[model samples]
Target: MKTAADIIIELIEKFDVHDAGSRRAHGKGEHHKARVELNEAGKDIFGEVENAVVRLSNAATNDKVPDWLVNIKGCSVRFNHPLRPIDIIGINFPYFPFDSAAETLDVLYRIHFYLEDKSAGRFMDIFRAGGLYRDLGKILKWMPKSTDMDHLYYTAHSYGGEHYKMKLDYHPGNDRIEIYAEKDEHLIDYHPGPAVHLGSILINPHSTGKEVKYFDVLNAPPGMPPNGNLPLLRHYVYKRSFLRRMEEKLLDGKDLRMLEEVWAEEKYFVLSKSQRIYDEIRELVKKGTDMSATRFRELLDEAYALKYEEKHLRNYLQHVWGHFKDEADESEKAHYTRLSEHPDPEAVNTFIHDLAIKYKEPYILRTTMVKTRGRS
Candidate 1:
């Protein structure tokens, strides 16, 4: 029996989406950092979170697709938990198309093949294999077009054992509803379970149009499922892809700077970049250059926190390498072949460059970078 990670790795390899540089899927995105003062409802679940990094994405496989082409859209809210942040991932649909993680992955695989082959027989085979055939069928025929992401109620589904499910409620008029301290025992995603109406997310009025790069789902709370499929699976596949590329870079023995270029896009790149800035600031402080010591101290604290997160992630991956190694080689081989023959090598670059330019409209991506002081 293959592990969930193994199946994910297979999906990562077989799909052309993972071949892209940073993100595996939904690479077309806009990022933001906001100050969040949790209301009583949110405070109950998350005690206090000062800052958060948010990313909104068009549910695109690659950068080529325009907004509204795909009915699905996603947003990830990563709470800045001082030590380690957790991302609350959500989509436009109130409930996921599939019933379980296992089923979700299985259906995704079948759907991909069906799209390529277009065999009606193979299409119904998915319905025959899964109990929720009607739901899956509905998903296949769901809105293939979506012009506005603002009105749709983006639904959260990262529930492991939590009693709450969040919805980014901007539905209709005056849709913002306050969440009370009560659990709504209702059926969602075709299952009857106790849930809480996690209040709507509103953009901070003060800060707008702030520059943000991208959001990582790796920071999700411990034991929470970061979806069984794409959008965030790039974290693992990214490391694998990085290592393979590094190996080939060594074998070719070409420009050593190419290694710098490659490593700059990986996970630790930001840390080193931060470290460089820290060093520059340290020198200024040593020179007795007049500056805000308070701001300097805050910078130091954030750097230390990020360093701790880096170390923690490295240790975790090292521990799990043995388990994930089973399918590592096969996945690498698949991506390597694509690297050799892929005609549009610039697709990834285009997607990345477009992030800063394409997502300017407030509806597509909001301007939010507020420093929340106290809870509402």
Candidate 2:
């Protein structure tokens, strides 16, 4: 297989959204203009999806340094199914927390880059704040004949798993209700909360028995089946096995069991002191230099933490690989292909470039770099 970078670069060459040299538009970037104009009402939805991806990737790395990001085959197909389109988004950002509130706003800086990308105008409008409504309204009122309104989907994500839920006390007469948590009691104990809520699709990867019952309660109308049975919506859960992309699969009975294990041990340890690590990065960012002698100590501690995460991940993957090789299935084999090799910097760059093409928009890639004892 080509290195991740090679695949990413190839995708960028084919899609050509932006150039690394000048960050300038070099091709007819608005290839999917119709899709963007039509799906104006679902902008926030899309944002949510992207956010979730970022958060998941970070969690996979334990929110540490030596950061890296994930790359994939392509977006158009991964997201839209058979009719594949080249939609890829790369997220890379400093993992360290900002020193002050003002620095937090920097999170939006990458969005601006997407807004200015000529081709991305086809499906996304990063300018407006009231999400889909405000931006699409502006587009329609100003250029009524200039765009369509049908080809878009909404997405979302959560950082601490707490952000994806309802924040308001009262409903404002909106049709969108909070998707309730679901789980299988035979498998897991508590819900990881709802991480995905799209249109009518309510997905909770960490649901349990009572949670599954809860899902039925929220989705069904106030009535029992003619036979007095409850209606259950079509739902899937991850089966916790060594299969690759198992995380992407619908949560299943096995997955619930694994989640039960995760819940039991998650609080056992605070793997690393992240704040100390972040303080060092903040000093570097603010001054572009750290004058204090102790700054070196801080940097060393951060680097050590990163190395630990890298080794830990490698060890876990090694175990997973052994299990996968032992009892492989077709779906398991396919996932193995995607995770077959570890990602490197060049591969990562290509992945990000491809993501830009897939989304037809610019995105932030929060990276976690790591140095493993393996040959390229």
Candidate 3:
């Protein structure tokens, strides 16, 4: 029976808005006090949104606060929770500056339409305007994957110069561009043969050449990690090299095939009818910001009543919109209808539990045959 206003009221109550008032005191007479006040108001609105999400899920409270409320650098809020441990590791990249009116609109459109987080919108504004890491050591730490190998992983943006050594020969001066410090001695070794090279004749499970896979930054499943690698960096490091090799192979009249194959896999999650509430939130983002914060929270409450909030609402929606569109035949409808009729919570739970296990299982390739038929 709770309305969106009710849900919004509950969520806004959780946050101490007075915290903003005290924090602004430190700013004294500066504009920062005004900024703090605005942020506090934004946070209040966000609380309403968060409350709506909880109501829609119809689930118990969690110790981990939802990711949206988490403020990074008192600026951008994370869009959502990271899916995996590795997903938490973030990489710094340059964003196009927002200056012109068109540029500002373009940026906002991307954020509102695709990114779906206002705090993210703010962070992008600051970083995109030409920021720098002056004293590297104070901010970031570069630790090696192993003491033996030259490979390094970055901890923070300030110490990012540690990665400059690896790319010093090929791309000098701009230390931020190529920052994963690893030895680059064999960079040009991709070519034909069983040895996996860039212009290799054939690539398969047994091939030993380099392989490339592009991870979707925005469309990744909810439980997976966040996109940390810069798209431009990936393009420069892999796409450019791959394209060059592909052109070379084409000139030599070789048939091209997918070098790295991603086998289609189904990942599932079990949730009660109440948990499916995230769908409302997802749908809301697609809608323009026409609804006041109060109205959106109301829709969320009704949504939570239908499905128990589980971990995979985003994943489920992705699969449905992407794969099930054409497959919604009579049988599929019957299947959902049957579930609705009987509502086997245990069966759904079991299915999801099994799926989680399956997802966690890593791929292992077993060779049944080896081409002992050697040099041609």
* TM per prediction: 0.50, 0.19, 0.23
Candidate lDDT values, in order: 0.43, 0.25, 0.24
Off by over 4 Å in 1: 1-3, 12-19, 97-102, 136-145, 151-162, 170-376
How do the candidates rank by TM-score, highest first? 1, 3, 2
Question: lDDT by residue for model 3 over 1-376, one digit each (tens)?
Answer: 6423233222332332212211210111111000111133323222111110000010112223332332111111111222211111122211212223233333333433333345755545533322222323322333112211112122121112212111101111221111122311121111111211111011011222322222222222222211223321222222222322232232221112222121111112211232334344445434433323333334433543444333344334333333333545576556544544454545433333333323432221100000000000
lDDT of 1 by residue, 132-247 (tens): 66666555554435556553433334433553455444332432222222222232352324445444444443333442333443444433333434323334343333333333
Shift in Å, residue 256, candidate 3 = 42
By lDDT, the best candidate is 1
lDDT of 2 by residue, 257-279 (tens): 43333222211111222334445
The weakest ten consecutive residues by lDDT in model 1 span: 367-376
Candidate 1 — which pairs collide? 209-367
